[model samples]
Structures are given as C-alpha cells and as structure tokens.
Target: MAPRKKKNASQIGSVSDNLPHNMGPVPEIIKSEIPAKALKEEPIDSPLPDSPVAKELVTPAKVTPETKKKAHKYKLNYEQSPFPDHPLPTPEVAEEVHRLLSKEHGQRKAPTKVPPPSATKSGCGEVPDLLDALLRTVLSANTSGVNSAAALQGLIQTFGAVNGSPNWHAVSQVKPEDITKAIHKGGLSVVKGKTIKNILSIIHAQNVERRDALLREKVTGEPAGVLATSHLTQIQKDAEIARIKENPLTMAWIFEIKKDSEIIDELLKLPGIGVKTASCCLLFNMQRPSFAVDTHVHRHCKWLGWVPLNATADQTFNHCDLRLPSHLKYGLHSLFIKHGKTCYKCRANTNPGSADWKKAKDCPIEHLVDRELTRKPRKRRRIEDSDESEGDSKVTSVKRKSSGSTVVKPTKKAAKITQSKPVKATPSRPLRASAVKARAQSSQVKDDSESEVEEVVSEYDE
Candidate 1:
C-alpha cells in the first residue's frame, strides 16, 4: 500500500461539523420511545414519578411505631398450672355459709395464734416443735382421731421417749419394718413409717452437715493451742448425739424462710409432703394464712361451688387460697372437717335409712349446696348371666366346675395341617458318549455268553 499523507489538525472535519445543522427538535415518535425523566439524572431527595417503574424504585417508608398490645391476665399466681380458675362465690356468701356451718356443727377451738416475730417457736396445740407437728399430721392422715392418737402413743411406747419427746434419732437408726410395727394402729403403717423414716434421714443428714460447718467455724476461730481434736472431743460428740436424740427434731431453718410459697416449696422437697400436707403444716403448724384441702374440705368446697366439680384437691387449695379471705381459712377448714363428720346429709357414705340421719335432716347450708355438683353414688352395671336368659334354645351355658376330687381341664383346640406345594426337579447333565458305549458293549458280551451256554446245554441234551 502506498504511503498516505497526514492532514493538519484544523483541516480535518470534527464530528459536530459533519452533522447537519438543520436537525430540528427530536421527533414525537422518538421522544415517545425514550422516558422524559430518564433523559437526565435527578437528586435522590426529589419525588419520584407516579408510575409502576417509579413505584418499585421509591425508597422504603420509615417503619411506623408498633401499636401497644393488651397484656394477658393470669387467674392464678401460678400461670403455668394446668388447672383453670373456676367462678368463685362472693366473699359475703362464703362468710354467711361459714356462719351457718359453725352454728350447726358447733365451732371448733380456734387455731393457736401466730407466734411473735422474735419468737423461734411455731407449732400447733400441745405439739411444741415443727417436726412433732409434721409427724402428728402424717399420723392423722386417713385415720380417726382416736386411732391416730393411739398410733402416736404406740410410737412413743415402742421407741421410748427422751425428755417426754419420741427419741427421733433412735427411730431413724432402726429398720423401717420396726417403725411400721410401732405405728401399725395408724393403718397404712408401712407407707407412713417409710415416709417418717425418710424424712428423719434427710433432716439428720442436713443437720449433720450444718453441725460440721459450725464445728469448722469454731475450730478456725479458736486459738492455735486449742487442737481440732479438742473441739471434736468424745464427750462433745456424745453430748451432740444425745441432743439429737432428746430434742424433738425440729426444722427451725424452715421458719427462717420469709415467703410462704418458698416454705411450702422447701417442705414439698421432703418425702411424703404433698401440697395438701405442706398447706397443713403452713396453716396449723406455722400459723400462716394457708388453706389446706383435705377430703372433707374438698367435698364441702365442691358442694359449696367454691371450686369446679372436677377440681382436684390441690386445685381446690390453689383456688380457695386465692379466693377466701385470710382470716376465714382457719375457721372454714375446722368447720368443714367437723360438719363433714357429724352432718348425716353431708357425711360420706351416709345411710339414708339410719336413725342418726335425723340429726342432720336439714343441712345448714342446703340452699348453698350445688346439687348438680354434689358427688353421687356411682350406679353399678347389672351384668345379666347368659344362663338366666329365657327363650334361647341354641345357647349352651358353660358351668364352672366346683372344687372337688375330680379336676376339670381346659380342652385343647385341634391343629390344622397345611398342604405343601411340590418342588420342581432340576434336570441332570447328559452322560459322555464313550461311557455310554462302554456300558452297552459290556451288556452285549454278557448276553452272547448266556446264549452260548444255552446252546451247549441243548447239544448235551440231544
């Protein structure tokens, strides 16, 4: 190719010079093809066009403040409990009902006053110690007062008392069977005895740990000359052991607990102490405003419509404690027990035909009783015997053989034989030609020999 000549910078036409200067405003068709707003970039603060494209491109709105939601109210203090709250009668109605029951049943002795805050002792009646109260309450469970008292007496006599209190340390040391023997009069002795023994063991273990901690603190505080052995002298050990025996085993630490719920929780951790038992201890022993629901209380509360018909004893207690006034708890519990026992109409298993029914022909709170909710005797199903049925000719009744010299045996069922399917035989491999020919030749030779022998015998006969 030939060498090209270079043009001067000014001589060459620019792109703008090459374009026709007469080009008018953009055609309407071309303007329609391109978006007017897209032709130029706008600041972010500017409002977007009211179109589908602009709608997608618009910035997300500032999140609006969340509206407040209503808080849910729990019926009982324990929100997680399975039982639901039942409609409670008015406090006035409850008070009036209590009055009527008190009048009819005769008021029980008022519960002992709560001990002063400074006082360390807290117990019910003659039972001066917390441990004694618990044991007495356990003995009284599911038994008559006389029987429970006798059982307690039996325990005292069998174990022998130290300083007028049952030697709990000695009881703890003995076998569970011995304790059962001691409290057999209580009924359910085996269970009660085991429970008592376990409670003692747990308390004894805790007490020992506490004593050791104290001893360690004492030993640390003492002068270096005073040996650890001196602090744990044989005499001191014997005296400590005697103290555990003579002193009614008391859980004084429990009294130190401030909250009633916490005290009940601690008591529940011990063996055989359920919500009812714990409540009993709280009300009668600790003199707290805790309402206990026993069989009598449970029955009366249901009849009075204080709790749902299907409510369990623990459920009854939870609802009643919350619903009933603090002052009424002690009186109501005492009145219910007394009325349930004495009132013929309300008492469990009351005989309608009995002469004693006259004593309580008219219940004190008959109008208050929820007749629908009151427990009724369950109707037993009448089982009709097949032999007793008439007009059944095909039916042969089976008679149970009487116990005698001849023994009746159960007949065995006949066994069924299952038919088996025949198995298909597999074909055998073909024999070799040489082996076959050899067998044939041997048979032919034998036949020829036999014929020759026959011929010779014929010749000899001729």
Candidate 2:
C-alpha cells in the first residue's frame, strides 16, 4: 500500500465546484490588554461631578466648519397666536363705552373736601388692609352688601381688641362656636367660620416659614447686615417675628409682591378666597390693578360684547382682564356694580318686558348694548267653552209623520214655513217624492262641500 491510487479527474472537479467561492480574507480580532492602574489614572471630561454640567463636552467631536458656524447663528423664531378667545375692542369703542358710563356715574369724582377721619367707606371701596378686606369679602358672598357690612361689623365688635379694632390673632384662637356666632349676621356662618379659621392657619404657617428661614440664616453664622431686623437685638427680633405671625394681614411680604396677578394667585391659596374676592382685595385693599368679575360685571361685559355670550362668570373675568387695560379695571368694576343695581333691566331676574325694565329705556350704554332682548314665544292657548247648555242644544230633533209616507223631516224653521198651521186630512196633494229626494241630495252635497273646505283650510294653516 505504499502508493495510493490517484483520484478521478471528475471527482476532483466535483469537490472543487462544491467549495466556497469569492471569499475575502477575514480580519483578525486582536484586543490589546492594558493595566487597571492606567485606566484609573485617566482624567474625567467634567471637573465638578455634582454640579449642573452640560451634556456636550467642552471639546465636541470634530464637526465641519459650516455646521459649527450655522449652530452659532441659530435663533428661535416664534409665530403669533392664530386663535384669540376674547374680542379686542377698538380704542374708539372703549372710549365711548367709558364715556357713557362715566357720564351716568358722575365721572368717579374724588372727595370735594376732606371729611372727618371717622368717616370711611368700608369693604372694597375704602378698606386698605389686605386681611381686613379679605374677611369682609368672604362675608359678602351670597348675601347683600348691607348684610355683609353688618356681619363684618358684628365680627369685629365681638372679637375686637381693647383699641376697638379687630384682633385677628384672638379671632384665630377663638372657638368655632364663637366665630360662628360672631358672623351669624352673614349667611352661611358655619361654613364661613371654618373658612376663616383655615385661612388663619395657612397664614400662620407662612409666618412660621418666614421665621424659620430668618433663624436659619442666623444659625449658619451668616452676616446679619442684610437681614430685615439686623439692627434689633435677638429678643426684639423674636418679638417682631411673633407680631408678624399674629397679624398676618400686616405682613410686609403681602404688599411687597408687585404683580397684581401674583397677589391674586397667593390669595387664592387661602380658604374662602375666590377670584372675585381676591381681585377685590387687589383692586381696593392693595390698590392694585385687577378686574373683579361678579354677576354685574359679567352681565355688563356680555352686553358690551367684550366677552362671548356663552362665557361663564369666571371666563368673563379672565377675558376682560386680557382685553381691557389695567387702569380701567377698578373704575369699571365699581361703576358696573352701581349700574347693575340701578338699571332696571340689569337687576337679577329682570328682562326687557318686566315692568321695571321699562324704566331703563334710557340706559347709558344703550348704544353699546349689542345683546338682543330675546323673549320666549308665547304658546297659542286653546279656549274651552264651559257651558253645558250650549253643548247639549246641538242635538237635532226628529219628528215622525202619521201618513204612510217615510220622509226625513227638515229643521224647525223649514217645517214651520211648510206647515205653519195644522191642515185637515183632505187627501191633499201628497208631497212630491222627487222633490223630497232632490232636497235631501242637495243638502247632503252642501254639507259635504262645507266639510271638505274646512279640512283643506285647517291643513293649510298647519
């Protein structure tokens, strides 16, 4: 077996044909191993690991000059809003509306002479204290202005300090029954009392936060030169902080917030404070520009077309604040309230046809009133006759003849004319049968024609 037999040429060719063709040289996977210490010695991309760092490294991956230049020149281009919810009034229209209202309301004249310091308008008109106005506004809800004022007076009288002013700290500490009894003059006493207490608690919490923040700075060994009570001793500072917590309405921070919108937002965080109440505080107490929308404001704005017909009272408030300038908010709100009370048509539950509305024919904004006075269509009432005699008399009376002749008798009038007097039976000429048949046929045709005409007319009316 020293020499092996040579393979056939055909077998070698078949094996070669089955082998893979067009194969490229495979690359070798060679991984270099380095020391662990070398990896630890490498520097990180960022210097401060805990600080807020940009995701992009200082040395960005290589980029083209054109890309880098374009990136530097990038800017945001914002498009104007396409859909606006509130209607924007022309300056002329606004001026006209204001003029008409001012003319009727006496132009909001200032005091002609200095009155005694004792005389003062309360609530939203002349109340300057933020917390005082807030409490008064809360009392005003769902009640008349007079009742609200009386309720506020009752509360202050019950809980007022020896100095004859409301002691809010004492009020906060009083029992719920005391709060309720004091504010019973205002409707919804139980609910309003809880809201008052809650508001006080929130304010107290804020005051505590402010106190802690100040004390924290002191503990940090921070310099006190910038602190509000830096000049006062530590004991005095504590007293001042205590006073701030007690009389939260007089807190410096409440009036320091510049934006009326921001102030309104803060007030909304308190219990019993709504948009109307907050806005009232902003406009009157804070003397800041804010639009307070109430039932009157809502109705008037809708009539003036500043707000849409479907807009709710809250929506009307936001819409007016956007469309009307800030300066006009206070005056317009006051005037609208006055006008709504005096205007016959503007009063609650009054419409154009009401007797009181007739007196409002000369309304100041008559020209600007775009809202239509729509009255419901009256239904057509059916009139029913209650007389029984009239209904019973409709039956027709029939008479039978003794003669061997069967004939339908005519009405009383016709019978009276044909046989007015009784006639002796002289075998007089019998009534012509043809005439009787003709008369019956003609009457039936007349009755059918009348009925057909009536049906046609009724159908046409429908």
Candidate 3:
C-alpha cells in the first residue's frame, strides 16, 4: 500500500468536508461591510461587520485578546541584537580602565632633575660650607635667596677681605653689627652677624674630624687608622689655607679637632650645617659623594616641567635617589644650581618675557584665559559721502512738443552752429542745382509765346 500524502492549506475545499460554500465557507464567513474613518464627520464612518473567519482570512484589526492568547508564541533572532550598528562594552575592557587611575597601586616615580644652567658658582665665589649657609640664610632673610646673595656680595665688597673662601669667611666671622655702626652703609647687622657666625662654624667643623673619617677613606688607605691619618693631612691643608688667608694661627687649634673618628659628622654638627650645608661640604669641600638641594635648583627643576611643582626638598631628594644615576649626581647638582641662578626669574602675570623668565612665573593658564576673555574683536564699517549727487536715469512720461515748437531742441549745448551749417538742410535732395535753373528759364519762354497768340486772336475778332 502507498503512503498517504499531506494536504496543503490552499488545496482544501472545506475545513471538515461537512459545510457547503453557499451557506458560508465551512471555516470562514464575512457578514458585513466596513467604512473607512477618513470622513471628518464621525457619524458617516460605519462600524466594522462581524464575520466568522478562518485564521488566514482575518485582518489584524479583527484579532481579539482571546484569539491572540490562543495563538502560539514564536521568537525571532538574527546574528546580533536589533541595533546591529552599535556595539556595547565588554567586561574585560571596562576593567582595564579602572586600573590606570588607581595611582597608589602603581609604581613609585623617579625624582626629576632640573638644571640651573645660569647659576654662577664660578666667578661668583662659593661660600665655604659654613659661610655659604650663612650667606644663603641672610640671602633667605626677609627676602629671597637671590636678594640675600646680593646683600652678601655688597657686604663682602664693603669689607676688604673679598677674595675667596678663606677671605669671605674672615669677613663673615666679624659681627656685621660691629661695623654697621662704623659705616651704617651696609645690610642688616644683627641678622647678618648670626648668619655669618653660623657659616664660619660650619666650615670650621667640616674641615675638622667628624665624618672626615669617611672622606679620607676615599683614598685606597688601610681600613681603620689609615682613614684617620689621611683626614689628618686634609685638616692640615685646610688649616694652612685658613691661617694663610684669615686667621694666621687658627691651624694649630683646628688640629686638635682632627682626633675624632668622622670629620663629616663633626662638620655637620656645627651651627648652620643642616643637610644642605652638610651635602654642600661633602660635595664641594671634600668633593665627596652627596646631593645638595638649594632653592634655585629646586625651583628650576619644577620649571623644567619634569616634576610637579611644590615638591619639597626632601621629596626632591627622594626623587633623585630613584632617578639620577649615581655617577652624574655631583655635576648634575651643581649644574642645576648654575642654571637656575643664571636663567630663572620670578615674573609677574603681565610680563613673561622669555623662557627663563617664565620658569618661575605664575600658572600659564591664568593670563591666557583672562586675555582671551577680555579682548574684543574689531568690527568693519562703511562710510557714506553725504554731499555726493545721485542720478536716476528714467525717461520723462509727459507729452512732448511738435517739431516747430520742439524747443528747436537745441542740439544739446552744440545747436547754435548756424555759421558753419548750410540753410534749407533737408535730408532728401533729388534735384541738382543746374536742373532747377533750366526749368525756370523754359517756363518764362513758354509764358511769352502764349501771350502773343492771344493778341493775334483778339485783332481778328475786332
């Protein structure tokens, strides 16, 4: 036996083969007409008719909640969501962004170095560790480091011993108060006095026996005693220079201090020997390994835009510890000082003249924003000449005169040229001058002959 085939929906004549088409289709029927609601008057639009309908024959409007509920639910899907054009963020991408702003979880940054290219340690003469501190202190007094240096230089010149480290120290040791009365021409006496004393004391100790042990160890001498003995030689040299320059006999007294284990520590213990001073001594005096940070160098570093501004000296130290290579530190520190002193200046908001000038100026955005806002753009304008004449060239519409009264329309301003123009100047001239003369003569002769004939005729009649 052959297998039965399935019937297609369109091929069916009746739903169950029980109803006839005239009565109404077995599965569907339409019993009424519907009017469109396009009419403005609501009363003319008819309500739709009711009808038994097959699922396929029903309009969407005819579907009821009950019929919809009975219909099977179906789902549709494509390769992506409905809005295939735009993409949504994924979890992993979002997670990466959160990590970057988390600064604390990140690595520590190396210290930034700014050079003080113009800062002059050369001809300007460095203060001894102690005198440098004192001068710098005085320089830092009520004014900035720069001002103090100016005052210190003024004091040095006013006094006679302005040659070098030894002479400068000699001058610093005397109380500026002692001489302010003598001249009253110099700087703040009592203040300069304390500062100078502090500097001298620092220099005195640096050359003596504190951390001098470490300094002397730089040589390839034996471990313990060899270090002390080498420092002994340096002490002798410093004392000799001091005595030869200022205190002629102070060397003998300084040798007594050479008995200690560490010259650098002893030097640091002096009145003005803070870290900067100590660092200065290790760096400048003994030429040892140490980093010295002063205001100019600190500020110049910030101007380089390498480090954030407002970094403290200690913070700068920490930064340098990380970033600066060990060997370059000595030259770098001095160069930074030089550059800052020579090139940097604190400028006002209105005057940032050059690169160096702007280094210590206020925030850059300040003037720029203010200038852009305060400035006005220039406008263009047109001027009219009030006295100028205007011509409106329209022809007149009123009736005009005939040829005789045509105002003889004097040919513009040139019409009174009678002396040069011929008379009877009509445009058509078919007759020649000779033809006009001949015609007049022939007419006279004919008139005479006619008169003669009339006379003869009259005589015969008589």
Best by TM-score, which number? Answer: 2
* Candidate 1 structure, TM-score to reference: 0.56
- Ten contiguous residues with the weakest lDDT in model 3: 453-462
For model 3, residues 1-462, the per-residue Cα lDDT tens digits are 999998776766655654655554455566558864675755533234453333334442343334443321111111222223322222332223223212212321212431221222221213333333334443443454455445545455556433432245446457656434322223465554565565555555544543354345546454434223344565564444445355422223322444221433454445534445545544543334454666655553444432344456544544543344444556556555544343223211222343444565343223212222212232311111111112311211111122211111223223346447745655633333333343344334432232110101001000
Per-candidate clash tally: 0, 0, 25
Reference-based lDDT, each prediction: 0.62, 0.59, 0.39
- Give lDDT tens digits, candidate 1, residues 15-113: 565436755333334446655674666655433465455567647434355899543222225333334445575689778988898798767544466
Best lDDT goes to which candidate?
Answer: 1
User: Model 2 over residues 232-263: C-alpha lDDT tens digits?
Assistant: 57676666567676665454566656656566
**Can you rank all candidates by lDDT, best first?**
1, 2, 3
What is the Å distance of residue 421 in model 1 from its true position? 37
Off by over 4 Å in 2: 1-85, 109-122, 161-165, 221-249, 359-361, 371-462
